[model samples]
Target: MEFWRYYRVIRRRRWLILLGTLAAVLMVVYWNYTTPTMYIGKTTLMEPKGQTQDGVPLFQSQMMGTMLDPQLQLSNLGNIATSQKVLSNAAQSLAELGLKMDPEDILAATSVHPERDTNILAIEVTLPDEQEAKVAADAIATEFKKTYDELNNQALKDSRNFIEGQINSTRNAMVKAQDALRRYKEQNGVVEINQQLADSVQNLYLAQTNANQAQINHEAAASRAMKAATELAKLPESQIAGTSISRNPIWERLSESLTDLETKKAAMLNGVPGQPRRGPNHPEVVALQAQINDVKDQLSKTKSDYIASTQQAKNPVWQTAYGNWFQAKVEDVATGAQAAAAENVIKKMKSEMSQLPAKEAELAKLQVDLKAATDTYSLMKSKLDEAKIRENQGSSEVALRTIDPAHVTEAHNNGLLKLALALVLAPLMGIGVAFLLHYTDNTVKTAADAEKLLGLPVLTAIPGSKAHSLPRQHCPEIMDVAYQMLTSNLWVATQNQADNGIVMVSAEPDAGRSVNASNLAVALAREGAKVILVDADLRKPTQHLIFGVDNKVGLTNVLSGGATLEDALALTRVQGLLLIPAGPVPDNPVKLLRSPEMKEFVDQVKEFADFVVFDTPAGVTFPDPVLVASQVGSAVVVHSAGRVPRGSEAELRQRLESIGVRLIGAVLNKVRREDSSSFFHYHRSYEGVVMPQLTSGKKAIKSGPRDQA
Candidate 1:
C-alpha cells in the first residue's frame, strides 16, 4: 500500500520483473515486422425513379408500385449485388479483360450496404492491389444490374400472359350469354313482345267482363220466361187462346149497340104491363123480346170477330196471359245461346293470359343474361388493350444508375499503435508479477522488510560481499563502519538503561549473530571503550574461532566455578577488547546459564568492561539468547538479509518484548551494496584496508596505523 513498500518489492526482485518485461517487449516487436497490407475500392448506386413522363404509371409501373415493398427493396438489392450469379458474371467479365479471378474470391472480397433513409447502395471491394480492387467493384455492379433487368423482364412477360388468359375467359362467357338469348327468342316465337303482351292481357280482361255481363242478362230473361210459362199452364187452354180480346175495337162497338137495343126493349115492356095485361104476346112485349134476341146475336158475332182479329195480328201486343208466356219462351232460348257464346269467349281469353306470363318471364331472364355478358365483355376488352399497350412500351433494361464509380484507396494499418500499447503494458505486467513474487517469498530481503515484520527500527545495513575468505584476505572497513554505526545507535538507544551490558541474538541459527557481535565489540574497543565479547552460545560457540582465542576456559568454566573470572577471560586481537568462549559443551548449558553464578559473572564482567557484548545462540529455536537477554541491560537482534524468515523475526521480537528484554534495535546484515539506495551505499566505498590476521596470544594493532583513542 505504501510507495516505499512497493519500491522495495521491485528492487528485491528486479531480475525477475526485468526478465519478464524484456520477453514481452521482444514478442511485440517481432510481430510488428511480419504482416501484409491491402487496398480498398468503393462505388455507389442510386435506385430508379418511381414515375415516368406525364406522372402516370407506364410499362406496368402501377403493378410494380402495388407489388414492390419499399422496406424489402433495399435489402433485396443488396443481396442481389453480392449473390453468386452476379459474382460469376463479374468473374467472366474480368477474365475477358485479361485479369482472371475466381468467382468465390470475388464474392468473399465484395461487401454491399444499403444506405439508411435513402435509396442508395454502397459497394466496396478489397484486394491485394489497387487496380484489382477498382476492377472488381465496377464489374460486380454492372453484372448485378444486368441480372436485375433479366428478372424484371421475365416478370413482366408472365404478367402479360396472365392478363391475356383472363380476357379470353371473359370472351367465352359473352358468347355463351348471347347464344342463350337467341335460343330463348326462337323457342318462345317472340321478339320485343312487351307491347303485344300488354295488349293481349287487356283484351282478355275486357272479353271476360263482357261475357259475365251477357250471362247475367241471359239468366234474368230465362227466369222470367219460365215464370210466364208456369202461369200459362195454370190457366185453361181456351183462356190462353183468348188472351187479346180486351184490346179489340170492333167488339167494343158491337157490344155497345146490343146494350142500347136491350135498354129500349125493357122500357117498352114495362109500359105495356102497366096498361093492361096483354095477351100472350102483347105488341110491346113481342117487340122487346124480338129486340133482345137480335142484340144478343149481334154481341156474339162481335166477340167472335174481336177474338179472331187479335189472334191473327202478327206484331200485336199480347192480350192473353198465355200469349205473353209464348213470347218469354222465345227470349229464354235466344238469351241462353248468348250466354254459351260468352262463356266460350272467357275460356279463350284465359288461355291467352296464361301464355303471356311464361313469355314475359323468359324475356326478362334473357335480358338480364345479355346485359351481364355484354358488360363483362366490354371490361375485358378494355383491360386487354391496357395490357398490350404496357407490353409494347416496357423497357427491358433495369433503372439502376451509377452515382459514383469505383475508385482505389490505401487500407488503414494500426501496427504502430499496437506496438506502443505492448510497450507500455509489458512493464506493468512485470511489476504485477514482481509483487506476486514478493508476497510468495517470506524471507527478509531488506531492512524495510525486517522492520515491517518485526515492528523494530533497523539500526544499519552492513553491506555484504560475495567473498567468503577470512578477515585478513579482505577489507574490514565496510564491516567496521557498519559496526561503528551499530555501536553508536545502541548506546543512544539504551542510554536510560541501568547497565551497559549488550546481548546480540537472531530468530534462527546461521543469521550471523557471532560475526556481528565480534565485529561490534572490536569496533567499540577501537573507539577507546573497554569491551568484553563473551561467547554465550555454549551449544555452538564460534566466538573463540572468530577472535583466534582458546576456548579451553570460558563462560561455562566461570559459571560452573571450575575457574576464576580473571582466568576465564581471554584477550582478543583488538586493543581494549576481551574474548570469552564457551568453556565446554556442557550436558545442560541452559541450567548453567540460568544459575546464580551466571548472574554474578554478568555483573562482574559489566563492572570491569565499559561495554560487555554477549554473543548468544539464535533465540528462535534455542532459549539461550532469551535467557541471556533477560540478564543483560539491553538486547539487539541481528538478522541476515535473504536468510531470516520474516515470520521468525516477528516471533523473536514479540518474545523478547514479552519477557521485558530491553530490545534496543535490529541490524540488517548481508545487505547488498547495490541495493542500499541510501546514504549508506555512499559511505560503503570508504572501507579502509583489511585488518591484519590475529595470531595465538598476540595483540593485533590497526593495520593502517589509525589512532587507538
Candidate 2:
C-alpha cells in the first residue's frame, strides 16, 4: 500500500521525469561529440640485475644483494627520468624534431612507472596527434638515457678521486711514523733493546755474586788477624831466656862505703844512745844524710858501669806469632778493597738494568705506530686501484637497457560510460525533485491528509470522475458509492443535533462543493429519506449546473424577500430529492445571507426534508459560506484532492466553528484510485454484487418518486 501511494505520486509527475532524463542524455551526447580524440605512445626499459653495464658486480656480498630493494631503485630511477634537467633536454630534443614544446608540457604529457614483480619500467606520453606523441616519447627516452649515463660516469669519477685522496693521506702518515721511529731509536740508543736488556741482567747477576764472595773473604781475613793479634799479645815481645848474676869489685867496694855512710847517718839521726842524743832534723844530721845520698849515687854509678849478668838468646814461638799477625792484617786490607770495588760494579749494573725497561717500552710504542701506518697505507693503495678500474669502466652499478622503442596507439574513450552514468543518475535526480515538490506541496492529497489537517474525521474518498465534463448523473458507480458513504457518515454525525441541515463548503474554488452537495442529497434520498440540496452560494453558484435545475429564483431570492420558499423549491430527478439553485448571483451575497430571513429559510427547509444540504462558495474567497454555515448550524467540508491548501481548510473550519456551526467532517473528493487506502479495495471486490442492486434500486426510486410527485 505504501508503494502504491508513492507510485501514484510518480505517475502524476511522470512527464517531468521523462523530460529530465531526456535532457541529461542529450547533454552527454553533445559532450561526447565535442571532446577531442587522444593518442598514447609507450616505451619500455629494463633495470640490470645486481651488475653494471660492464658486467661488474654492484654489491660485494650476498647480504648486500638481499638488502637491495628493486622497488626503491625503480622509484629513484623514475624520479631521475622526470627530473627538471632530463625534461629540459627532452624538450630541446623535441624542438629539433620540429615540435616546439616546453618542459612543463612534456612533463604533463609523460608518465613513468615500474612494472609489478619485475625490473621493467614503462614510459608513456599522451597527446592529440599520434606522430607527436610518438616523437615526444622517443625524445624523452633518449634524453633520460644520456642523463643517466652521464650521472653514472660522474659518480665513478668522484669515487676514484676520493680513494686517491685517502691513499695520499695514508702514505703521508706512514712516512711520518717511520721518521719518528728512526729518530726515537737514534736518540735513546735503543738498538736491539731486548738483547741489551738480557745482557745487563746477566752482568748485574755476576757483579752481585762477586760482591758477595769478596765480602766473605774480607770477613775471614779479619777473623784470622784478630786471632793472631790475641796470640801475639799473650806471648811477650821477648821471653826471659835465662836468669844471670855477676858483681864487679869496684861495685862491691862502693856498696860497702855506701853501707858505712848509711850507718853513720843513722847514728847521727837517732842520736847516739850513749852520747848526747841529737835531732834527725838538726844540721849535723841533715849534712850527714846528704853525704850518705852522695855516696849511694856514686855506688849506683859504679853498679851501672859494672854490668850485673845477662843471657842474649831470641824466643822462637813469639817471633812466629808476630809474623802471622802482620800477614793476616795485610790480607784483610786487600780483601776489603776488593769488596768495595765489586759493590761499585753491582750498583752500576743495577742502574743500567733499571733504565732498560723504559727504553724497551718506548721502542715498542714507536714500532707499533709504524706498523699501523704501513698497514693502513697498504689497504688504501688496494682500494685506490679498485676505484681506478671502476672509473675506467665508466658505468653505474644499476644499468638500464632499452626493451622496446616508442610506439603510438589510440587512447581508450569513456563516452559510453558517461552515457550509462547519465542514464542512471538522471532518473534519480528527477525522483529526488519529485519527492521534494510532493512534500513541499501543502494541499491535501489524501483522505488522511484532509483529516489530519482539519482535525476532523474523513467521511469518504470519492474516486475522480471519468466524465468530469458531464453532469453528476453520468458519474461512475464508484463515485455513487463514495457519495453514499458520505451521506451515511453525515447522517450519523447529525442524528442527535436539533437541525438536520448542513452547509457544504470548501477551502478554495473548483473543489466540487456543489457537486458533493447534489450527490449527497441524491444518495440520502435513495436511502428512502427526503433530501433537499440548497445552493446557498449566491456569489458563485454551481449546484444549478451540477443538478440541471432552474436557478432564476432560489436561496438568494428567498433570503432577499424577492421569492417565497415554495416558489424557489424545485424537484430533482433523484427519488425523494429536491433542489434549490443559487437563483441568480447577487451583488452583495454576504448581506443577504446575514439577514434574518436566512435563518427562517434554513428552519423551513429542515422541517420539509430529512436532510437539507446547503452548497456554498469557497470560504477563503468570500464570507457568504461562513454566513450561510452560521445559519445552518452544521457543516461538511468538501475538498478536491491536491486542490485546496490545508491552511485554508483549517481556517474555514475555524470560521465555521466560531460562528457556532458544527463541523461534521470532511470529504476528500476527486482522489486518484491508487492514492486510496486498503479500505477502498473492498469496493472493487464487491463491485459486481453492488452494481446490480444499485441499478434495480434506482429503477424503483425513479418509478416510485415520479408517481408520488
Best by TM-score: 2
User: How many Å off is the CA of 500 in candidate 2?
Assistant: 3.1
Q: List the pairs of residues colliding in candidate 2.
A: none
Overall lDDT per candidate, in order of appearance = 0.70, 0.74
Which residue pairs collide, candidate 1? 243-319, 243-320
- Lowest lDDT sum, 10 consecutive residues, model 2, at 56-65
Task: Give the alpha carbon lDDT tens digit for every residue of 1-709 in model 2.
Answer: 6787788778767888899999999999998998788999999988777554221222222112122367877887899889999999998888887999999998999999888888888999999999999989888888888887776676466556655776787689789989998999778775565765555555654565566556645765676678779988888676666666666777787778878877676555433322333577888778888887887787767753433556656656677667667766777898899989988986675566556567664565556456656766776677667767776654644446789999999998789999999999999999888888887675667888777767889899988865642235465667667776887787778778778888888877988887777777777777777777788877767777777788887877888889887778777777677788888888887788888888778777787777888888888788888888888888888878865342566667777877787888888888876677633575558654646433223322123333455
TM-score of each: 0.52, 0.56
lDDT of 1 at 536: 95
